[model samples]
Target: MFQKVLIWFLLSAFFLTAWPVSAYLPSDPLYSEQSYLAYINIPQAWDIAQGAGVTVAILDSGVDINHPDLKFNIWKNSKEISGDGLDNDDNGYIDDTSGWDFVDSDNDPSPVASPEYSQLSISHGTALAGLIGSVANNGLGLAGIAFNSKIMPLRILQSDGEGLVETLVEAINYAVKNGADIINLSLVGFEYNVALENAVRQANQSGVLIVAAAGNAESDQSAKDLNIEPAYPACYGNNSGDNLVVAVSSLAVSGQKSAFSNYGADCIDLSALGEDISSLAYYNPAQGLNNYYSYNWYGTSFSTAIVSGVAALAKSKNLSLDASDLTILLKSGAENIDALNPDFKGKLGTGRIDALKVLNSSLPATGKLIKLNQSSAVYYLDSEKIRHLFPNQNIFFSWYNGTWKDQTVEIVSQEKFDSFKIGQNVIIRPGTKLVKFQNSGRLYAVSFNGLLHNADSLTLTELYGDYDSRVVTIQNSFESDYTRGEKLSGLTYPDGSLIQYDNSDKIWYLEAGQKRELTDDSLVLNGFRSEYIIKNVNSDFYYNIGRPIKNLESNIFTYFLTK
Candidate 1:
């Protein structure tokens, strides 16, 4: 007879470098067991205000809908009927009461049973949700940054943690339409799709902030092979003035960048607590695992969720601020991480997000301020040429065939006019009158547009009006090709081209080559419907460089962000 080994768990302090396994044990749970709260500067985060009424939409594998910590915050689409097998809201989804599952063609987006990782391990989404907003100070499991905030759980990725572009787009659209204040996407891929970019732009335009994981591919420090780009969406820049997307990095106990975390000065925006962070695990009653309420994981994915939760807190306090302002606040509030390379400064953005700084600071009004560098008269252009200009003044210039055209103009005052030169920079004082110049001349203006890039060029005709407007034209070409607000139908594409559904009958196609369209019933073979449809398919090509793009089976268990 063998005496059973009685495992006696003990509790301990939650040290930055130390794993909080003991703290996670039910006996004497410590605040450090709540990774975000213990590691993150919470007193600072709360000064701004707990994420009160804001809603963060988690677009990942289906969350354990019945989790004790998450039941209260899960989004419920009251307008959409549940289990009736009918599209009640007329939004294409049928019975999407909680959320629609793109991996499986059913309304109940629960994790499936599997051997690789127990189906009970539908812990990824639940853990992510916990990071965003678990019941705080309730003397239950653990506390979340935005304990008061709500969660719109969108099941875009499957249990195996795989996702498709179509499902992602649909989830994004849903988040925007459903009033999600912040969107957390801990997924990453390489392929660039125009439709996806457009969808992100649309969401930002709608004032919803987006946060993504910076990826876990350890930084490439070799001088010859240094990697400057992190991952997609995180790498994509927003045309809107608002800073819509942020790429987050992880920090270790020694305050150094985690070895598995990815960092790009140009691509990454900020850093957050990610390594060995603890959060809720899915409940498994059958295994007598009710006591195992929390688990520790690492990756920028967790950091992204923390930032999203902070964004929710910000939104709850100030409902007027748009996505751009929120991004500025996060960037401006971050504390520098010592482990980061000096070369990454400013490039990695303002630094790691400081929750307390954002909560306590008095935010500026919604619009961004344009501060002309009064000390510097010469501004560097993309061509490496320097232009002499005055501070706080707007200018117009023309470019033809990629070369500066020799035509220019100087409108000194809003009420006064001056002769214009086509190629030279024109300086305009405040309240300047508008004048139209003939020929296809491009107009350039600099304004504090809340965009990362300050200056923009537009066509002369677009600026043709008595009153100066915020919207300026950058191109003056008069081709019959698609102009602004023009709609066409029935486009065709080649076999290998990637297609994105635009409407019932149209699709936006993209590839390395030129843009084309695919029509007829062939669209069905490629996977498209007049209405939104979700299905798991098989493809050899990786949807994302590191992950499989498509699923081979209906039931798959994948992880979202790997360490």
Candidate 2:
């Protein structure tokens, strides 16, 4: 039945427009009630905010920008003139007053038939657009989740429902550059593209929220399948802070997972209504009568659009929300669907999105998008695998160029280097900023407040607490800035102190500059805090990378080795 409904969705992907080109307010609604808004409790949400002034970029087939319901809500590239056949804004697009169509490589992105037997071409985009932002309370067909948000139409897929990853990547880049606050992608592809992945990362860097479909499948898109090879862009990355992508699966009206909707804990972020959904539909009739029809749509695509609308509304209420804030905002406010999806469990994500709860929740807004310090960086284990997010972005290594490129966080030490040599798919991330001493040329870093203190030597067993303690690992060290990883016990260093290995008893020693008698019980080393940082690499790669150590020191850093 779900497949049958999905086929129904695809077959009518576009209702050929038979009505006047411009959409006008309708006298009657097709549904007995705006059940979705009532079902999703959007009225309560709207009491707080409508999606006013936010721009949602829709990268679908194309939209009926002239449709009466969407004409006013459609985004206009005010900088570029339309039909001039020129790239007026010098932004690589000419006359893209509305939006550009990548499939045809043209400026007029209105949906049209070309790929032969394809009803899934035009209407789908228009439907998605109306779902995101159709003029509301004007006696139109249906009120969208973010009825006041603006929709930027980027026609990446062809009329025949065919689109390439390359086109999608370009569309993402275009959306990021065009001042898009939120991007809605209702399509899906099987394979992952590196270029596309990087582009999505860049979008997050630019602070744009992304909403994508978990996809419709004949069978359940189980969490296992999704985690193994998740949907593209949607499953890009779901780490805390700086995450832009929110993957959504569909939930039936019964509050159960849709049989055809994909589900995954790692990728899928929210569950929304997908069954018997209603939105805009366009049809070009033989008689050329009224072409626009109020149609009830189904599938995850529509649900994805609905979620995007909710995000827009949230942003509308809280204007200071960055991409990361919006991402966390939607998730934190989600109504967990775990009890209903007991068989699927966390795969459905933080459950269905709650507009009212999200609006009422005390999630704070953020002005800064990119992190600026190592203390603000974070790491987590997804699928039992380590992932990282940092102020400087991900870890990077450059041998001669001295330019840092995006690199994954993998910790390694000099002792562990021989087993898995560098350049063998190794990504180096330092525990802290490693600063080079002015004269020694050696790089060292500290994780704590770097309070200058006289050295008080303690035992490896006493100083570290436990040898097998998990905090002893680099992963724990990075998270707590070596504060959790190390135990001064009662030892306090007024100056910045560090744990140095003695190599004799296989024990660790505390070294700050305190000239104490080197005893088996306690030992002290002589070194100033700002002189240098300690590093193992001696190559000519010009290894200079560090953040200010507050008022204690400037331009200090640390590095960790990992493959």
Candidate 3:
């Protein structure tokens, strides 16, 4: 039973998916600066790069191209004319003027009603797109992360928020071939598909970076841990020391690990703003694309978009920066948040992403990056004014999150800046215990996000004269697809809405009101062939649907199948 969380994070039983649309929902007119934008110093980055001249492909439940804030930033394939009935771009897809929609097998990639969410709730693509590259300074809705980057909307997941292994593979190839510099995958599942590995490899070869969510399930799926499952594509690492994908975790505005975020000492790259985020959402009846800055949009999926936008911004500053360069800049430049999470020292990826640090680094910097002595980081001077040395720098740490970045200050004995000398550990932030240094011969364990291997250590003169690993990523998201998914004990009704089971009371009742005993014995959470189903009674029809949908609930059924 693989449980999937929505990128938008609505967190309802029947709606294992995310995102919404209400005409009466309040809109933020002057969405000047989100708390996260200020936290990450995005305003400073805006002066350097807004991801101009870059193509960021959103492989999700299609983008609302008609959104007032997103229309200008949408990538228009000049080679193809809409509805011309011709393969205008000569790219296999016929008349793909804006982008291709793999689910509906059509050229239109507009946001649609997901069957899983009561046949009215829209998927997450539009909101995620707003975060990545919605139009800026247009005097409309909220400003996007990469305000000027061209957005290529590719719909691979079904509207119900599920995707197939084959569909994902084709989407990766499509994004790569269609000139996507970065791809955001906020969705995740426990299943491991070999085709995904191959697709990621191909994307890597094409110099396309895939930023994936570390997943919303709070399982501690670390690299060394054997009890839990690792998020796919995000955990897809090759032995060649080349990572084309970056796994991202979610963070609250308080700069602490979100309660819903998945953490691993070695399974994640870095975290970004995912809690109570504000962006643009799609409303039904075309209410001119309502802004969603007030309603909290939560998920690692949103964080993935943030990272992808940052990558695009980095690419803007230096076009030569590839996936590897993007990776390094993000990991190293992130604000060291290990101080915020003492219990999760090296496990919460590198740290929270900081736009100022990333852009200030002058990414694509040509030099052998320095490595921090994970066990022996110092403040360059001791309390008694002495130079310190720890020979066991290499033995103290292991590879987990992408990089371990510790800020170095010119050593001064008296300060509150969280500086340290040899054999010193302190409380840097609330609930965070950072071990700045340890003794020479102690068998200390360290975890890093980068791939661990043979190290030919080189000393550099950056950050307290400490040599650390060459930290790397720059940014991922996915939709909710729980149909064909197993019956978890505390799970919702299978494709049946308005009705739910109370495990505690052992009764089924209307979710809109109270619980009652089921009068119908056969009214079990009937997988695909629910009382709400009509067309397909056999298992074959359900399995081939790509994602699960309630055919009987409403006339609109969302299923992804390669045409």
Highest TM-score: which candidate? 2
> Per-residue lDDT of 1-563 in model 2, one digit per residue for the tens?
00101121321332323333233333325434447877777878888999987999999878878877788888899998777788888989888898888878888677776636355445788888887787776655656778888999998876666677778888899998888989998887667777878888777656678888887774423323477767777788664433448888889888899777777768888889987665776545532424575455677888898889999999999775656667777888888878887888988878888888888876432112122223344332121122333322322221111222333332222222222212111122222223322333322333334311111233323433332321111232333332222433333321223233333222111224331212332211121221111222122212122321222111112222211
| Model 1: residue 30 alpha-carbon error in angstroms | 5.1
Find the 10 residues in a row with the least total lDDT in model 2. Answer: 1-10
Winner of 2 and 3 under TM-score: 2
Q: Give the least accurate 10-residue stretch of model 3, judged by summed lDDT.
A: 473-482
What ordering of candidates by lDDT runs from best to worst? 2, 3, 1
Instruction: Write the residue-wise lDDT of candidate 1 on 1-563 in tens digits.
Output: 21111101111112121223333222224455555564557746675677777888887766766766567877788888777888888877888888667667667655543445433235566778878877665545666778888888777665555567777777889888877888898877666666677778777656678898766653344211114443666777732233448777666665566666666665677878776666766655664335335555776678788888888887888876557667777776787764455544444455777777776665432111211222323221211112223222222211011112321111121111111111222222111122122343422222111111111233322222122453333222311111222111112221222334323333433333332344444333332232211112112222222222232111111000000
Q: State the lDDT at 185 in candidate 3.
A: 86
Q: Please state the error at residue 476 of candidate 2 in Å.
A: 30
Cα lDDT for residue 387, model 1?
A: 28
Error of 1 at 403 (Å): 14
Task: Show model 2 residue runs off by greater than 4 Å.
Answer: 1-32, 115-117, 219-224, 239-244, 283-290, 364-563
Cα lDDT, model 2, residue 538: 21
Per-candidate clash tally: 36, 52, 33
The TM-score, computed over Cα atoms with residue i paired to residue i, of candidate 3 is 0.59
